[model samples]
Target: VKTTVSVIKADIGSFPGHSRTHPKILEVAARRLKEVEGSILIDSYVTHCGDDLELIMTHTKGEDNEEIHKLAWDIFMECAGLAKEMKLYGAGQDLLGDAFSGNVKGMGPGVAEMEFEERGSDPILIFMADKTEPGAWNYFLYKIFADPFSTSGLVIDPSLHDGFTFEVHDVIEKRKILFNTPEESYSLLAYIGAPSRYVIKYVWKRDGTIGASTSTQRLNLMAGRYVGKDDPVMVIRAQSGFPAVGEVIDPFRTPILVAGWMRGSHHGPFMPVGVADANCTAFDGPPRVICLGFQVCNGKLIGPADMFDDPAFNRVRDQCCDLSSVLRAHGPFEPHRLSLEEMEYTTLPGVEKQFKDRWEDLPE
Candidate 1:
């Protein structure tokens, strides 16, 4: 059966500050999805990564289906209302518009979805991140799909030898391009290396089977202001012709630096953590990512095993802490803080305006 897996997320509200999601918000989302589970959805799971509430659902409806989008929007609206009653921080912050349109793409929430025929024993991984942007997934996706060293299957396994194709999006230009890997891998890097602009939206196998999909919505760009980080989500189908679960997740062990930390302006290590530890605390985050493994059978989601909740990842967590300290020490300096061009959507422009009059031309 052709099943569509949709992972939609938004920061409707959180407790105290933008550190963690309120339990009540999650409860409301769960109850709301349950109401239409058997009718509209085949399966549903509601969870959170830091302040963002993620709704993972399976259905027969294809990508960007109006009914699926509306269901998610209505749930977020109800949750936002409850959040306001509880006086939660940033309540309804991501619901950019007053009313739900036919879709939620530009409305504020981050959506990553794909529809595919279910393979026998189809294993998939859902990655939800908080305190980061859609570009944050670029590094790992490259390593998983292109780099042979990162994924030995690319070199060893015959099924993966032919390589994959990446569907990259230029978020600023609102354009997309495809590059077949192992061949145009160099060309692909030239764009995706600059994550803030070019993001890998989807990856497909040589046979045209879908390998992965990521939410490429840039919230600041959509709202035309510094609302918050995009806090993206991704779905990667594992095993069979795709990379094994281990190969797909192995890249994150390095703890690479990504934009969106405190004030959504600083660069910090992207730390992998379990759902239980997926909250922003230090410096509003060293931006956290959580992976949940699932098996899709007959359009139903089963076994969301917390992939990163292992002792093996403890060393990387420590490395992230160390890196965070080093970066934070920079304190508003470049390489730690984003460049002026990237901060255009942020409040940096306003700060520059304040000092505009006092500034004089420096030594020519």
Candidate 2:
């Protein structure tokens, strides 16, 4: 058996406050996917992460197929139109590039796909994130594949004792050169810790087994302009030879901080929340992530175990809620405000323009 899972996401609209998407808009997207089912998908699901709408599709069309990508794009565009009708906020917001071109790669959305030979039992996890860049997965990936404390498989399971290798990418570079983890763990960590410029593209076990993969592509890098915020998406294959679901999910439980929110301009903890949860409070977010569990067979989707609903996660959410309140109180001050580096890609340019004269006299 073979399985192909494609996870693509776009920000069609957000409420007037730029916090959530209109329910009707999501329904329109569902309707469009239903219309294209026979032509494009085997089994599909639609859901939101913050203000973005994500289309989780199972198909044999392979990655980046125009017929498939366009189907999702058209649905989002239609949803965007509906958002406009309701006068929703940020309608058609993240559709940065003028044309969709061959695919949405750098146009504004985040895309991650995996095609592999199916196991006796197939399991995959879909991750949708709001308020963070592709690099948010840095720590999670490191924990799942590198740390034995988190992934006991390394110490207890012989099949996983050998650490995994990661292909790290320098997203800022035009030419993509990848460096590996384990052997180059320190070097990889040094680069990925920067987050904004480096991202984890894929990971494979020491014995050559693929552990995970993510679409490290960033839109602002390609567009040369910050059209809108980057709402990233991810997919990870769990169990069997890879890390167990527990390991993959362990890192998120900590809701450790990352950069993103209200225009992709700040750092905050990546809260793990359930389906239907709204965006962050105050200046937009403490950043959030949603996980969907699934099993695939013969190139189709099976289960999406809305992981956040489990009783164990309930405690984590409580912690997140408390953290949000504390952080919100800080408002625009240090530690709460996005660091100056992360602010560069956002509206800070406009702020910079206001003080452009400050540098005039010191320069030629």
Candidate 3:
């Protein structure tokens, strides 16, 4: 059976500040999805990463299906309503539009979806992040799909020997390009290295089978303001022709620095954490990402194994803490804070305007 895995997420509200989602909001989302489980959805899982509420669903309906999108939008709307009642912070903040159109892509919420034939034991990983943009996934995607050092299967396993293709998106230009790996890896790196502009949107196997998909929506761009981080979500298939679950997740062991921390303007280490510990705290982030493993059988989702709940990842968590301290020490300096181009959506413009009249020309 061809099954579509859709992972949609939005920050409708959070308790106290932008640290975490309210339990009531999650409860409402669960209840609403449960209502349409057997009819509209084959299986559904509701989760949260920091303040972003994530809805993962398996269905026969293909990607970007209007019905599926509408169901998710309604659930978010209902949860946002309950959040407002509880007086939570930034209630309905991600619902950029007054009404849901045919789709939710441009409306606000981030979506990453892919449809494929279910293998004998279809294992998949859903990664949801908070306080970061879509570009945050670029580093790991390269390691997982292109670098043989990171994924030994690329060199050892015959099935993966042929390599994969990366679908990159220039979010600013609203264009996409495909590059086959091991052949154009250098060209690919030249673009993805500057992730704030070019983002890896999808990865496909040599046989044309889907390997991974990421939500590339830029929330700040869509809203034309500093509403918040994009808080992207991603889905990656594991085992068989694809990389093993271990290879897919091994890259995150090194906490790479990504943009999006406090006020969606600073750079911080991308820390991997379990769902229980996915809330933002220090510096309003350090930017947390949670991985949930699942098995799809006959269009149903089974076993959402929390991939980061192991003691093996404890060292990395400590490293992230150490890195966080170093970055925080920079305090408003470059490398810790984003560059001027990236600060376009933030309050930098207003601050620059305030001092515009006092500036004088420099000596020739």
**TM-scores of all predicted structures:** 0.98, 0.91, 0.99
Candidate 3 error regions (>4 Å): none
lDDT rank order: 1, 3, 2
Ten consecutive residues with minimal summed lDDT in candidate 2? 174-183
- Cα lDDT tens digits, model 2, 218-297, are 76666666755566777888888888887888777785777776567656767888786746565687688888988877
Q: lDDT at 266 for candidate 1? A: 90
Task: Output the number of the lDDT-best candidate.
Answer: 1
Task: Give the Å error, residue 113, model 2.
Answer: 0.8
Error of 1 at 96 (Å): 0.8
Worst 10 residues of 1 by lDDT: 355-364
In model 1, the Cα lDDT at residue 360 comes to 79
Q: On residues 42-135, what C-alpha lDDT tens digit does candidate 3 reach at each position?
A: 9999999999999999899999999999999998888888889989999999999978889999999999999999999999999999999999
Question: What CA root-mean-square deviation does each model show from the true structure?
Answer: 1.0, 2.5, 0.9
- For all candidates in order, the CA lDDT equals 0.94, 0.76, 0.93
List candidate 2 stretches off by more than 4 Å: 177-181, 206-209, 358-364
